[model samples]
Target: MTIIKNPVIPGMAPDPSIICVDERYYIATSTFHWTPGIQLFESKDLANWQLVGYALNNEEVNLRGTNTPAGIWAPHLSYDPQTKRFWLAYSHMVNMAGREFNADSYAIWATDIRGPWSEPIYFTSIGFDPALFHDEDGRHYLTILEWETREGYQAPGHIVLAEIDLPSGKLLSPWHRVTQGFTTRGCAEAPQIYKHQGAYFLLLASGGTGYAHGVEVGRAETIFGPYEAHPSGEPILTSSPRHLFSLGDPDAGHFEMVNPHSVMQKAGHGSLVHTHTDEWFMAHLMARPLEGQLLNPLGREASIQRMHWTEDNWLEMEDGSNLAKMTFKGLAGVPIDNEPNTDLFDSFQEPQYLLEFMTPYRQQHQSWVSTQKRQGFLRIYGGNSLFSQMNPAIMATRATSFTYEVETLLEFQPNHYSQTAGLGLYYDSNNWLYAHVTYSEEKRCPYLTLLQAKLGQRIEYVNTRVIVPEGNIQLKIGYDHGIANVYYRLEEQETWQILLQDLSVAYLSDEGVNGMPGEIGGFTGLFTFIGAVDAHQHQSYADFAYYKVTNHSPAS
Candidate 1:
């Protein structure tokens, strides 16, 4: 048998929705405030996966001014065998003031996974985490969480179901309120429906998306009714099985329920699939914290687990334990060469950018960033500063490993200090660590400086400034766990000089950054980026010769 390791897809891939069509498996994940909204991955053997494409590649949804952890929420992917098409449903969260949680949900369809997708169909504003289920009899239904806003009404409201028309974007029937939650873990969301042996099964993500997170199940004879909970009266899958009761809590960051015994945390929000080989597997979201710290810099990742049906028709882990495992067994006949390819080197020789690169808060268009502008070089015209929620000229990739290095060759001549350009590590608009090249009037030359933003507070490393003659400079960042080191070298120099050493950047994480009050901070993971800033005028730009990233170790 093949041994499948955990986290088949790593780095900020959360809320995974898995589906199999024609024996080929596909997984869609959440992107939050990042553009090219939903991430999609494809796998052939269910052991090795590759980044295929994204659902929102154009200006389908606007994320400008979207707050931290509030842009594009969970994206649900399902295939309709009747129509021979793929359907994607997602939420565009606009505001979270006073915990009102205003959002607009939409669904789009395409004939192929890499699509010329149809325009979005407005579904509901009542809640988030919307999923679509197509019955065998040619009827479609939408399942979503009805957000609760009153003083006290069972916390996060109910899981409601409604029949919908795919062609006209209309609801055919009134919403039927399903069960509030299957277990006492509360905060039930991400409702998905499955049919097995003439019984409809309802699966839920419970106990929020935090430490107490888990996957619970229920079943009923009909589509919507008084569903019966699993006989276990607990989550069928979770990282922390030593449970505590949290019935009415609305908080998504349950810091108290962290499982110290397991290396994985927040293992929940799962989606199931039956393989072509008659095997069962589930794709779920999980997180890995920094060593000896509660802060999670890598955000939630994707992991797979082997599952089986019990004699009594209830779902259970293949090992007969509810706890999530770091390693599991794969299909017997499937052979996988599990060597990870996490390194990237982009020379900008091609006409198009790499598919792994993603931008935040704004769509990537030729007006701001392009490779055709300067052949063999990436020319990025600066837009706004890193603090702005609007447009920022940043092309970043997820940090997949804890021990990695990112390097770039930048050629920029800034007339003002506001037009700086270089490489750095970014989390969001409010949290980052930048090592950039800026002009200084007193020195009359370009210099390298380190800047950091922690919890909205800016810290400048004035003592580490080193003046260098301008032309082309090579910048590099070495990151190990929570510490970072910056280095630079001139075009003619044969050796590298350290600019900043042993700088603690542990605060650039989900738990360290401050977001909506009484809620989890940021949901997106850390990113290594090559960016530019033109706060003075949108005229100055930077030309990058090449960008490279090397991973020394895996996240496990």
Candidate 2:
């Protein structure tokens, strides 16, 4: 049997919700503060996954100014075999200030997974991480995390259930409080219900979304009565197995739970699915930090592991251990030649673009970005500055590996300094490192320069400068762990000249930097983007001939 690797989908893909239809599998993941809403992937074999499409592509909701880790929360995907439709339930978090979490939940349906999905139907703003479960009795139920703000009570919240009308998006029954958590791994959320063998099972993400993160299970005979915790008082699966001394801590930077021995940390928030051969596997979120660093620049990613049921009907890993593994035995008779990887090479020659590319906050406006305008090149018309959430002319792909190189061929003409277009290592508008070709007042011509943004403050490095001739120039950025090196050369110049080297980019991560007091650095990971900024006038455009990303890790 082949050894399937962990993290079937990598780079900022978190809170995975998986579903299988006709032996084909699809996984939907959260896209917080990013455009095109929920990211969807398809896989025939559980090992190999591909970006197929997104569910919320239209203006069903406005994500402008959505804060870090706060736009689209956990998205739950479920299928109704009777109606032959797919239903998705998700939370649109508006604010998280002073730990007073305020969010709105909604659900949408689609006949096909690659949807013409229906406009969102309002659900409830009671809490976050809303999930939909269609029962065998033709009754639909919605389970969510009931947020509690009372003093001296259980910190984050409790799992609650209620019957709801799928058509009207109305609650048919009152809220029923379920178990706080199967164990003391508090910060319980992402509650989902499944039935098997005349018993209902509730699966939840506990221990927050940090190094102590894990998946817990509880079961009850009925839909919403008394539910009992699993016999074991610990999580069923996790990368960090050590006890969390700060169990009740609400800090997102729970650096105390970091496990140095494991390659993948922050493994939890899982969803389960069964294969055609009756084998069980779960897709969960996991993170890979820089070699010795606790900061995960890639954010929590999607991973899967094989499992089996105990004789008493409890679930455990196939190896009978709660600890997550990096590799598992592949399914029998399913020999998928492709492995899990997202090394991109976009030539911009096709009519459509790859789903791996994404923009921030707003829907991608065709007037600003298109490949049809120029046959072999992607033309990006500059609009607002990179800091603007509305319409920044930036097209980026996730940075999957710590040791990867991103390169692009750009042809841009800038008459003013406000109009700059080049490559950037972006983590929101507040934190980023850019090396671009813009007009230099001192040089009185086009020149290459390096700029940095820390907490929304832009700083230009004076030492790095190179005069360039008019035409196409190749720009490359190499990231070795936390250190990033920027290089550029004209088309005629064979040797690359270093613009900046050994610049520390570690701060642009989920831990190294932070947003508000209660918020973490940002759940959104680092992105390698070709961005254009036109603050003076929206008349500038940049043409990129090609964009390529390569992972340096041996496994990649």
Clash number for each model: 0, 0
> Once superposed on the true structure, which residue ranges of model 2 sit more than 4 Å away at CA?
244-248, 515-519, 554-556
- Which numbered prediction scores highest in TM-score against the true structure? 1
Task: Check candidate 2 and list the clashing pairs.
Answer: none
lDDT of 1 by residue, 341-436 (tens): 768899999987778899989899999889998999999989898888899999999988888999999998887888888999999988998899
Worst-scoring 10-residue span by lDDT in model 2: 244-253
Tell me the TM-score of each prediction against the true structure: 0.98, 0.97
Local accuracy of candidate 2 as per-residue lDDT tens digits, 150-205: 78776687789999998799999999998744556888889999887888989988
Poorly placed runs, candidate 1 (over 4 Å): 515-519
Candidate 1 matches the true fold with a TM-score of 0.98
Candidate 1, after superposition: displacement of residue 338 in Å?
4.4
Sliding window of 10 residues with minimal summed lDDT for model 1:
511-520
